[model samples]
Target: MSIWEEHPLARRFWKEGRADFPIYDMHGHMGSLNTIHLARAEADQMVAHMRRIGVKHLVFSHHHALFEPSFRNVRAWEICRNHPDILRMYVAINPHYPDHIREDLALFDSWKPFAVGLKLLPDYHQVPLNDRRYEYALRFAAERKLPVLSHTWGGSSCNGYPQLAEVIHKYPGLIFFIAHALFGDWEGAERLVRESAGNVYLELTALPGERGLLERLTASVGSERLLYGTDLPWFDEYQVVGGVLSADITEQDMRNIFYANVERLLGRDW
Candidate 1:
């Protein structure tokens, strides 16, 4: 039998979801996308899903906010406001619109506890994360020590490891969450975590699908530097949770990944 077969938490999680292990999903998305269909993309539907899976908190960016040129973050603000108990938001920053970035940052504080940080989709936005256009938002996040979730991959010119390296070093104070953990390049992801000074975190969204990636990452960087993320509406929460529970890591490590690390990172902010 495998190690997880006899584990109490794993057994309970398999039987009744994780009622005892409350999760704080650090990376998620709301709203429907243009390219693909998402079954539970609405805020209420997502909240229902979270409750079913024992997810205590979720910080997400609306899909429209990331992809639409005209929409920006208006829907994100509205949705998060309505679901304040379980939802938080990332103010989406599109580098193409400097005015929108400035306007959003200017009004950010007013959103208060609802707006936890900023989201950068550099690859989709066609702007490198290290570019001058993103400076203002980066500077703002750094100054306030707020978290910034960037969509990073292995070899894309926009938010790839090279660009991330520059910005992470430049804005050390910024709590950086590397979305997808640089995707395909596992070695690069491990190196990025090893090289960074605690400010950088690897968010597990689509990663749990890979068999031993979680265990490997835990071994390399420890659980404290890793964060749980569902990429909700895009993936099933049970599958992600099962992946963690099934890993060879200890319960404490599971706790850290599910909620503890995020609680510490957000502090009293959430």
Candidate 2:
């Protein structure tokens, strides 16, 4: 049996620790490692996995190689549309691909789901954050009121954190979701949140295994600012989810961290 089925969390639609919780996995990629593209069945398998893990909804993003502007966001959109209640999407626009941004945004506007937000990966795409190329994307997102979720962590030796920090300062109203939440500078994330007056979003995907981190963060920032994500195939499973909820947080806080918070932020009941 799958872990979600085997665990007690599966028996209850909502845990006491997390009263009437509705899970919305806010981050993940849909493609496989061997194939350059995401096959339809493979994408379906991802949804099956989410279901098995009790994830009611997910905001699926595209892989970095597929983050082209000229092409349609078909893969991401298909996954979301296929499982309207189980998956949602965000366009991962490559800032360097200036021509594709408008088209991609138009597609997004047309499809229109919960649309957790935009996905940006400066390290994977080899572009430093705060480059002028992203200004258009940033400005566009700001205009649309779309949030930007960046895949930033320890591997980067560049100015990603600082440049992204600069972007935060540049656009006071732009909601930037910092994925991996500064693996290299966790404290820096805390400082940025304090300074930004809570305009910044610190996504927690890498710390589920470490129980203490969530508790520390919840106390520091108030669980309302944190969003639940699994980063998909790379880190999808109940062990992580359980560890995250099982951390030193009340079931109520766990429900907020895993469900209600994202629901409210993304403006969706499902």
Candidate 3:
């Protein structure tokens, strides 16, 4: 009965009584899961409830394309083009691909999504972040001022976080947001936050209100480096934002977490 196994991702909304809030589900995948599975149908129905609950947006990555550059970029474009209201896509670079950034940036130029960014899921892709193969993609993104969301978990072990760290340190100019807020490893994420300072950020998706996770991070690195994300369908909105809203933070902080940070990162007012 784990979240991932039993759809542990939906526990907060389904079980924690948070079905009413509008959820941004900053992190979710667009697929037939909702069409093929009854449980997923329930999840799709939950989207209307998300609107009621204050969930305004969903920043999604094509889970199937995370490992394939061409397919990932193409599918991401189609999805965003079709569902501009609720879904925005962040393309994944198969770093090893010949065209890399150009292949996707061309799509962005034509598609003009409200928010265009990148998602790197090194664990699933079996790529190492520090492998030096992603330099071109990272450099190109930095030059364009595009935000790159890297998958990091205290649990991801080696995958690509090392490369992610290297990319951040090397580019410094890139808007790098680490998803999963250290992936349930508060200490490691905190350390990265302290080290990155303002150069990098962390997304509060699965981490939610991990005890003193936010407080300690705020104290050390300032709350500005934190981005609010729900990992929708993966984590519950009520559990993610409720305790966070009640925490010892400011209205400005709340605003930043809810929308501003991501808006600023994506260069959009929303």
Candidate 4:
């Protein structure tokens, strides 16, 4: 066998000719990312991708929320409800609509167990991470003990990781997931996540085939603070999961990244 093929973790992962652990995709989208969109028939592609990849459950936000801030989350709730066995919803928030924010938070509170967390697309919406409008959502998340996943790039725009740093420090009790940090600025993401409180985490999605990005993230934050994500429908599911499986880390770390860490965040097994 080749050296990589002989590795113990590889053997276990591929012993049955597939991944050994149940995959819980922490990042996924249920709809199109556009002003105009297709119907549910097109969006079911996300469901098909999950089933094909053996993804047991996925946490997703509908792209409809990016534009239609008022009713998109309720639509997302319906999508998750329809696929209750395999899906959890992230209540999408747009800080631009302060009028709708309260009702949105109420909707999330009503969803309770079905609402896994909150999703903020500051990069798409161009809202600042430190914007006062986000406080209500953050406070609701803190009260509910739910995680808040936000779009984070590298530079110092309102949506950048630097701006998120301010929010992270302000609410140490809230768990923050830095989505797409891998594809943004790996070094800056690593530094920010490493320096912040343990409540901050980085989700591995939309990542390049860099030699040591995963290893460096594991080293900086350890496995418990890292999550696996596919950004499904936007990217191939197997490709994203395989990136973590191929990382040069121990089996325990692999287990954590693949399932355990997100399970801990969700407070239950999938």
User: Number of clashes in every candidate structure?
Assistant: 0, 1, 11, 0
lDDT of 3 by residue, 44-134 (tens): 5546545655666777676556644446567666756555676676777665664755667666656555446777766655667665667
Candidate 4 lDDT by residue in tens digits, 1-270: 842478665665455434656778888776665643534324466777677657778888877675676566777777777777788878888988876778778777667556889998887788788888888999888777788888877774876766877888888888888887735577777777777778888887776245788788788778887888877667777577567767777788978887888777665653
TM-score for candidate 2, residues paired by index: 0.84
Candidate 1 — what's its lDDT?
Answer: 0.87
- Candidate 4's TM-score reads 0.89
The true-versus-predicted C-alpha distance at residue 187 of model 4, in Å, is: 3.6
Instruction: Compose the digit string of candidate 2's lDDT tens values, residues 1-270.
Output: 654344455335324323244577777776655544444335678777667656777776766434544455765776667678777777786767767766677666677764656878787677787788778778877777687888777546433567767888998878878887776576777776777846787788887778488888888877877888887756755756766746767666777777777767666564
The better candidate by lDDT, 1 or 2, is 1
Local accuracy of candidate 1 as per-residue lDDT tens digits, 52-133: 9888789898888888879867668878889888899999999999999898889899887889899999999899999999
TM-score of each: 0.96, 0.84, 0.76, 0.89
Candidate 1 segments exceeding 4 Å error: 1-5
Per-residue lDDT value at 8 in model 2? 55
- Look at candidate 2 and tell me the lDDT of residue 202: 79
- The prediction achieving the highest lDDT against the true structure is 1
